[model samples]
Target chain A: MAHLASFSFTSSPSNSASSLSPLLQSHQQPHLSSPLQDTLINIDNSATMTNSYKYSVLLPTYNERENLPVIVWLLTKTFQENNINYEIIVIDDNSPDGTLVVAEQLQKIYGEDRILLRPRAGKLGLGTAYVHGIQHATGDFIFIMDADMSHHPKFMPEMIRLQQAKNLDVVTGTRYAGNGGVYGWDLRRKVISRGANFLASVLLRPGVSDLTGSFRLYRKEVLSRLIESCISKGYVFQMEMMVRARQFNFTIGEVPITFVDRVFGDSKMGAMEIVSYAQGLWKLFVAV
Target chain B: MTRATEAATAIGILGTIYLALLFQWLPITLPPTIQEFILPVLPWWVLVTFGAYSLGNIGYHVMTFRDCPEAYDELQVQISQAQNDLRSKGIGL
Candidate 1:
């Protein structure tokens, strides 16, 4: 945690008639040799205005130590090239592999103001991590992506420009829409992905093309409201957010991008997740 | 008096009648000749068992109609309270 030092100044005019007349005379004169002028000059010189639209990237990690440095480097390079004012908030769930240690090192390399390490005790759910990260974010827009290199930082500039051009409330990357494709998945995996999406669309009728994709950019308040309205956790959480976005009447813009499997570590998808996805779809179908 | 409630009540009554018919058709302690003769014709036990089971089923329907909806509403309230508590503590389900 970074310590913030705040300095406050208070001024009160004296009630003495002589002091009051001098104060009034100083105000009347355009240039006066008074302490008030010195203080005002000091304040004007000391305060510096910062740029607007600081982007906060919320990255939730569990055991992503090896991938942390590389992702941060990519993000830095991309932001520097585009001249985007940004900060990366790493929300680690206290991985046993010392992911926080790496994040701290990155903070030292890039100033603490640019990189923030917000860690929790143990493995909490993904939805909670985003909520926690957003609380500390100072940006007007929040970007969420995986730290496993599955989501590239190169697409960020285009996403921002496209969002500005269209004035969209949310911009999402879709793998199943128009020229976007998935690679490195076997026939069974592809079939399961397509079938699950089809089942959700048939039941919920969410307007988004890819309901299960997680790479998204949202206006900070829009994401907060959508997260509050959503009910599903884990893999189904992403689907629920999109469905709720449609429910609340938010404009959504989709950008086609290829989704590649993670380059490092193991995939988190399992049989239980598939079963839970089906059950969550049924629940949303009835509730929403 | 809704269609769903009436259908549920009808199904409950039919299930009770089926159970009574099965119990009467299969007597536990009957002489072989008497059982054979009675089983072949309309048995006296069938009517009595049907009467008891149908009455029991009708009692269940009346009890459910009186209390089931309120119980369901209470369960929903409990679930909502639990969700709000989790959210306040920064825990997401």
Candidate 2:
């Protein structure tokens, strides 16, 4: 009963159910109940013991020299404070702005074990960057986020907590759900984003909000399988990943996150990107 | 089933029902007033209502979308703190 009291709110209902069963059994066999409750408490302890699980953060970069160090710093700070085991795998696509140079400096500061640099030649796309990053990831779980400061590291612990509580295969950060919002977006940006989200929700019914949000956590095996199944580019890549996860019956959970847009760099939302997004959405609608 | 196929199947079922009613092919009949006045425009009514709902839903979300001024401020402080810490650690940023 005391062990059940310590369970987080997200998992409390289930914990309470298990805790109550022993109490109900106590009414039948008073002597046998103590050992039954002890085993239940031990199960809870073993769940927490699974914190030995390590996270591999795949931060794919292009021209984020100014943002890389700051994002890395925040990630390291968040993980360290939470006593989480994590490694930041920086996959740079040969940004002309010398992002790799800064990543190298960060590795020196954080050590090789913390920061793994996997530099690719030329401006290859994001999907390939993640694939390249995952090939070398050693952790039990994987985190994918933008190098831009828009996807903050602060909400990561909530995502991890939710994943652990629900035993979710994928935990996505949502900017449109409870306590979630965007910082730098104006009315136009808000309108466009909201409209796009509404359309996708109606059409796909993917059961996950914030389809375009890139900040997400996945079991390493689930992510590799998702990557193999996904078939989209640009903004729809993340959306398609959720759609495919549902198609494959992968459990998903959401944590609301504050999106700050880009603090140090220009955010990309051009007509071409929007056109590609529409095309990709339609492709998923028809093909998937 | 893919969403497209699901939607198409639903529409096909509904459309067939409507057509059966419209052509008087069904054993049972819709009321004369409904068959004449309402049935033909039901699809339009649904379309318009759905369009309005979509617009309203998006509008409500846009109006209510949170602006995290505090988060922005906190991020600024963290960024500068990170910069200072990195600088102190001898990593030129």
Candidate 3:
């Protein structure tokens, strides 16, 4: 009878549900746990194991053909050291300088699953590239950073750990925060960056200290929600995302990261970009 | 209308008429002193009317510029079709 009881408890749910025989129910039926109970317990265990989430790193590139290989190496090293399950999704905008070729080589080296190359025709702007990349990302969490090596991969592990520790919806890297600094920036560049951030904060009052920094990790669903709510494009896109995040009451965490100037290729900043940044700020101030 | 509003509207109308006459070959010009002083202290109605007129002119020109290239291509197509039809009907331009 003890053996039968053990067998009944270990059996599947269908078996136990059917085994509630009329004969067993007739005489002062002792509380007999069935195979259904064991099956339910196993299902719960499997569900918990399946819920262990991984991270997807989205690197949007234009023409950083020279910087691609080195940045991928750094990312691989960082994720490997942290023992985190992560995938790097490269969203390239069809760089004429053979950036896709280098990306293909990286994919071969790191297996197709780990390195995903999502390329678009022409330079279709930064905001859309991120949206396109996010559509294909399979991870529960998404990390966005520059592919130009300006945003270091070293800071990513800390951002991930902090997000995990606090259960934060978003973790952004700030250059203006404690122990964080920008290297290879002249006086004019620093002033422009600082002034832009100040102006945006004054107008929008986004709780984040660095509204323009693109290096951050977001819960995949949270990012999808935020991206849909945002309207601005190009450099202003980052600022608007933070503003929308605050409006939606999403929890945000910040980590200090040293932003280095890209060693390869020319800086994409220009006079028109600054003008558009100002215009974007004004639009957000009035619209939001 | 209140006296102030009447006076302001009158000034606006007079100024616009004066500008139209000047553009249409009227041999009249405001004295430097009047131009410097009176124009600076123009009433709100006068200033707003002038601004509206300027904005209307700008909007017209902007629309024209925006549509000119496409409009020209469309006109060319129409003219070519007309010429072909005329030739088919044994006529010439």
Off by over 4 Å in 2: A1-50
| Residue B24 lDDT in candidate 1 | 65
Per-residue lDDT of candidate 1, residues A26-91 (tens digit): 545746745555553343223212224779999999988767766777788778866788999999
Q: Can you write out model 2's per-residue Cα lDDT over B1-93, one digit (the tens) per residue?
A: 899999999999999988898888978867899989998898899999999999889998998899989899999999999999999998778
Candidate 1: residue pairs that collide: none
Q: Please tell me which predicted candidate would have the highest lDDT against the true structure.
A: 2
Query: How much lDDT does each candidate structure score?
Result: 0.71, 0.85, 0.72
Instruction: Indicate the residue-level lDDT of A127 in model 3.
Output: 75
| Deviation from native of the Cα of residue A115 in model 1, angstroms | 0.6
TM-score of chain A of each: 0.81, 0.85, 0.81
Candidate 2 Cα deviation (angstroms), residue B59: 1.0
Q: Which is better, 2 or 3, measured by lDDT?
A: 2
Off by over 4 Å in 1: A1-52, B1-93
Docking class of 3: incorrect
